[model samples]
Target: MKKDKHIDPYKHVAFIYPDIMDFVDYKWWAKYIYSITVNHLKKSPSVLELGAGNCKMAAYLSEDYKDYIASDISLSMLSGSVCKINKVCCDMTALPFNKKFDLIFSAFDSINYLTSKAKLQTLFQQVYSNLTDEGIFAFDAALINNSYKLQKVAETSGNFNGIKYYRKSKFYPVSRIHKNIFRIYFSDKVITEIHTQKIFEFETYFEVAEKCNLYVADCLKAFTYRKAKATSDRVQFIMKRKT
Candidate 1:
């Protein structure tokens, strides 16, 4: 769910995305994320998905909510989702909700795209203000371990609907940022996109939460019930607004 200039890269190839999802096992991913997230929610809570790309999770879990909104910065991406979810195209950092939510979530390391501590803090504050009393804010981040791994991976390439593309990743340790570069060869031209993400420290998240009036409720390893540590590859941070 990374982005460049706040534009979702998937929108550029939305036409060929069905094949892409099949290759990536999108159903399995959505189910896995849904299972991990739903276990932490209140029954029939009002829900909002921050980076509701393709509404994959919403497709599986929206029926369990009192009301559900699937949001993304890309209208085209939201348009492509096949689900009975209320789709909203909006920026996650600058949420435009007047009504409070019982739960707001973003999976697949969407929060990492904030790309800076200040941005993350701002996001937390926005989320805190939008949540109702006892509301939960759950999101995940890929730390430096994943950055290092991505940086070490060999170049990867793929073909979508006859169009060719290549992916390369780089990690800037000093900035704790990872950029995934994609070069796409279209029929008439070539385009490049660089998606950026930050690797925030474990304690930094808590510090931001405390400052934003959001309290850390749990820190769990992604895809598992184990406690998360600084060394964990990815950590799911669950926070609650101070009532």
Candidate 2:
């Protein structure tokens, strides 16, 4: 099957805005992940992060986990990162590792970039196959309800590393997807990029996990420790390998 072309635009943005890409802040998220895993699972084990863009999360986990590996399809993004990461360039749907990890993670709604059920199924299967017995697979996805509610917002601006960025976002109710267009006005030049992501139904995740021999250990609202509500913009899932 032909891969989705939607990611190409963002890949361009990633190349241009590599310095400003720290907006996602994977360091804080990694701390939270470590706390949750240690509190619940009670062990500091090997971790593999799929779609580990910029390696911020992997850097944060370097001291916490026994081993850390960061994988992403884009080598440029990984090369420009500040973190000391053992980076691997590979597709998430076909992880190249035969050894299982104690925990696997992909954050910032990276899974939503797949844009199709079949792709997501393949990703889940790979994650399941790469996890040790009873290991955890944690990830986040955009929520359809929140995407629809915030569809018509106008452009917003932010400044990073002396570069001014104008960002505009639109949501498609029919497809439950959100598209973000960014215009970066730098001292040297102006660049534009578009990013597309799907807002998946909460139930759809459970079904996908079932097909991959995984089960949800917990689901929570993104950026918070609270339980996920219907109106939440992002839903974080902690899945356990069933077999």
Candidate 3:
């Protein structure tokens, strides 16, 4: 079967919102991830970040781990990232690494791009196959319940150096998808990009993980180590591969 074309917009818009990643509190999130993983397992070890984008989270988390490998589908997005990272270009559903990581993770709802059950299962299998015994896989997904919260908001616009960006998001309740349009006003040209991502229920992730032989160890609210609630906009889950 052919892959979904929804991610093409992300490949284009990634250039405009490269700086948006800096808005994330990597230190706090990294500490929370480490705390939960260590509480369930043990100390920092080797780590792999799938769909790492142009973010510093992997680099921050790498301080505790012995080594960090960052992989993303977009080479341009990876190019904008800062860090002494061993970057690889590969699809998340079919990672190129072998069983080399104690922990594998992805953030910013990157997994939502998978958009289907089959692709998600493939991604989970890939993650499971690349993790060591007792290795953990953690990732975040946007919640559908929170999509309506921002439905009526006005369009937000911003600029970074020479690139100006205009963003607007619309939610589809029936399909649980968020469609985002980004209009980038560059020095000499204007470009419009549309990015769509499917939102999943918290329970859907548990089922997907179980299918890949990964059990949920902990599920936390976005940006904090606190237990996730039904209304949490983004849910972070830590899953361990059962040996």
Candidate 4:
């Protein structure tokens, strides 16, 4: 038996991300995010998307603003953009931009990737530093409910462009961690990527945001304006930079 080669998250799997996430409605999601942006800013605003893997959402979301940049930690992932968009490869907690953005958002529950509260606070501080005076920082977080429900799916496998891939998902309730292990077979080697997400409590987000000098404008149920409860599967938070 051959040993599987370990790779960084999204390094090799970025190539088949679209195929794996085919169920996502990027267009509709872009529209939903756009509505939130307009509701807060009341106009098209300069935009920055953090953890914009593959930039699929950027393809449609970028259309709403004249100045838009898609950023992710993995260069391989940013290279998978569906169309031409200003792409920056950088860490969300340590952004490397001089200019501020009016609207900074991350979709697909990307904020859950921060494994610790300190990192989450750092990310919010970074957002506070990079946001315009009236800027909004919007992001969705996958809660415990999402992880519990997804754990039932357990395993899935498929092939994309002749490359075979398999995924197994697990949730650790005690640790509040949701982990996904992926095995992708290339012609020569099998690459393994382990993706982990923290399942933060519903109220912890507000505490972190407040500590980072960011004001929580709203915390809504995912895809809607309804208030989110502790049992919500996912929630979207709208934060504003402290003036």
Candidate No. with top lDDT:
4
| Model 1 TM-score (2 dp) | 0.88
- Per-prediction TM-score to the true structure, in the order listed: 0.88, 0.84, 0.89, 0.95
172, model 1: CA deviation in Å?
0.7
C-alpha lDDT of candidate 1 relative to the true structure: 0.80
lDDT of each residue in 131-196, candidate 3, tens digit only? 888778888888876677768773888878778898898888788878888888878889888777
**Higher TM-score: candidate 1 or 4?**
4
Clashing residue pairs found in predicted model 1: none
Clashing pairs in 3: none
lDDT of each: 0.80, 0.78, 0.79, 0.89
How well is each residue in 20-112 modelled by candidate 4, as lDDT tens digits? 999999899999998877878746688999999888888888788768999998888887776798899888988999999999999988998
lDDT of 1 by residue, 41-152 (tens): 6777788899887776777667556489999887777888888768899888899889998889998898988878889889998998899887888888898887887666
lDDT (10s digit) by residue, model 2, range 1-243: 987652333454565555556466667878887766765453667788888877777887777885889888877667768877578877888888979898888888888888888988999888888888868888888887666655555567777667778878888878877888888876888888777787778888999889988999888898778898767888888999885
Give the better candidate number (2 or 4) by lDDT.
4
Candidate 4 is scored at a TM of: 0.95
Query: For candidate 4, which ten residues in a row score worst on lDDT?
Result: 3-12
List candidate 2 segments past 4 Å from native: 1-10, 15-25, 40-44, 148-153, 158-164, 184-191
**Model 2 Cα RMSD, 1 decimal:** 3.3
Position 137, candidate 2: lDDT: 88
Candidate 2 residue 34 Cα shift, in angstroms, is: 0.9
TM-score of 2: 0.84
